[model samples]
Target: MSLTHSVNMNWKLLIGVLAGLLIIGMFSGSSGQQSSSAGQQSQSRALEASNSVEWKKVDFLELELPANIQELRDQVKITSGKAKFFDQEIFYQTGAVPAGVSRSGRTVLLLHGAAFTSQTWIDKVPTLRTLAALGHGVIAIDLPGYGKSSQASVPDNGEFLARLIQSLAGKQPIVVSPSMSGSFIIPMLANPQYRDLISGWVPVAPVSTGLVASFSSQLLTPTLIVVGENDRSLGNRSKEDLKGLPNATLPQVLPGAGHPAYLDQPEMWHKLLHNFIIKVNQANSAQFMEA
Candidate 1:
């Protein structure tokens, strides 16, 4: 063969080899993109399944007004209900649907301090009636051993509360936990599964131990931390510890209030709760529209 023809044939072979490599690279890139898309879809489906788990309802006794609750009986009606969780009965109180306030699909789950029962919400803040009047569903529960709920050896109260929230609200409900109940809730925010099921949090003078520091950055839910002006230590700690939360509000310290600030300043607490609920709901609505 002529030298020039031989060199031309070599060049054609080199072009063909380069073309083959280009095709292989394109195919690999396409497969990688498909795999990434599949991964995202799987994650979305798993989250939806986690959020959609159904809870069974259990029988509950009628609430007989104790002397502590008798004074507010006429102003707001209360009903008792129970749900079974792992052979334990979880009792809860539901405030009556206030006249002219339509069910807004925005539910609030009230968890009280260690010393208080579900009645404390109504007795102290009248939160249930106030929330109901604002067109929200209100459920105040007696944590495992408190009030009428049966106690069990709960290994993880955070997981237990997450399940209780799922069962009670049938969707992501706004959680309002005061004092010791924060011990259970703040940790729950670390678990993505539990975190996905909650819409928002209102932690009032919560007992923040070491857990707050580790999981503060992992919090994805909208949070509001409220403390009393008198409870400076906890108020300052919460403000500093929870600064990592992406969607947290500036800590609100009620004027002239003590540890149980809600009891002393019910009106301010109610206003803040109402406003937070509205803000969260609006954000959720905007997200839904964007999606």
Candidate 2:
């Protein structure tokens, strides 16, 4: 390798090491300090996720990715601090649709996968927003330190999300969690405490490879498991997670897509969501009418 290239790689590696140290140190604070000092943490976090412009600070776009996917992903260099949902106050616009636009028919809780912030839905938002205009609420949330809410270290991710869901949903919400977030949803629903708070669940390409047991008969209630053809084991695992519940729907696998279809194919994701919302609302209305 050229001397210049080697030097660049070194700088990026150094930045990544520093970021790792800070992440560990910040989370290692005493309980009080962690809580108090956390409220005052700076919004900027520059973790070097890839080997680009090594001498510079860590940017969001430099992560390890395939060239095609990299070309598809266009995010900002700056990473902002977003709070965990239930940890603090996060205000959603009236009508529970989304941050932008109006006139949505149903509330959609968009739960993102791990290692990604809520902004991963940026490309998917436009398509979702269209449905919002036609009457479907879509919300993409950041898990603790992921997006532009408030920042906190993610220790108990499941509990954190449970609390976060309570705060964000306020009332019962129709949740749609993709990949790892899908696993979070299962635990959230199985808990009687949260089961009542969730109107329905939609797991997209879940990452519950080892959590198949959670899908026992009691957990199903208007659940939809979506997957992609290219997703190898997640589909089967997702099936297992919601196993005994007849109320849970089978996997709605997308064509020509992989594990991350929500981001990889926003249009397809939107269509699937649109159809699901309509069906859910329709069924809910019928039950009410019958009553």
Candidate 3:
């Protein structure tokens, strides 16, 4: 072979190698662009899901409830007692339906905030009697370290709460948790087994909501997120974080109220609570009928 022929062969080989490298780079760039586009689309869908479900809009006006627990007590029968709860005496108030009225078989477990106790449901707002009047059994318990209930020696809030509910609340009670009690309720809610035990959840400007934010989409025990419009931090942040839940409703915000909004507007707050209870019962009934 001549030198000229050898040089021509080398040039042909070099051209082929360059063309192959160029083709590979093109495919790599296209793949990177496709991956980036897929990521953006996923993020966009998540954002849409977060924003699509609007909050349940109810007209709320901040008003002082008539200061008369006696009036409410006279209307419904309320009994106070303490039950033994695993080394702690758990004090509670039971507002039974008026003697003749048929029972709805629904029990509501009322848990208080850091600043309040079981009596806050009875004295401050007549919450127990008001709910009882609706034909549902309402029990307001003084959590350990607050009110009449003995302080818990155990460190696990979730275990303590689960045991209390199982021992006290008869079969899938609707739990009403407010403020600091979120520390207890949020942990309980994170467990799927415990979630099965609760029929419904009402979290009122609950703290520690961030703990569940990452997996809240799976925490689907029909939840009603209640908050005050004036509560700018925990309330709003929780609303945003929890709104992504598949079965959660948009938050119920009380106008001109702050943290622990129920105290600020008891009448409106009670009305909302009653409505939520009714909704939960109806849903349960429907499921039973379907089954």
Q: Pick the candidate with the highest lDDT.
A: 3
Clash counts for all predictions: 0, 13, 1
List residue ranges in candidate 3 displaced over 4 A.
Answer: 1-73
Q: Write the per-residue lDDT of candidate 2 for residues 165-188, one digit (tens) a residue.
A: 666554556787877676566666
Q: What is the C-alpha lDDT of each candidate?
A: 0.72, 0.54, 0.77
Q: Which is the leading candidate under TM-score?
A: 3
Instruction: For candidate 3, write residues 246-273 as lDDT tens digits.
Output: 6677788888889888888877888777
Question: In model 1, how many backbone clashes occur?
Answer: 0
Clashing residue pairs in candidate 3 are: 55-250
TM-score of 1: 0.73
lDDT of 1 by residue, 155-234 (tens): 68888888888788758789988888877787677665567677778888787645766765555566777889897776
Q: How far is candidate 1 from the true structure (C-alpha RMSD, Å)?
A: 11.3
Q: How many times do residue backbones clash in model 3?
A: 1
Better of 1 and 3 by TM-score: 3
Q: Alpha-carbon error at 6 in model 3, in Å?
A: 89
Whichever of 2 and 3 has more lDDT, that candidate is 3
Name the TM-score of candidate 3: 0.74
Better of 1 and 2 by lDDT: 1
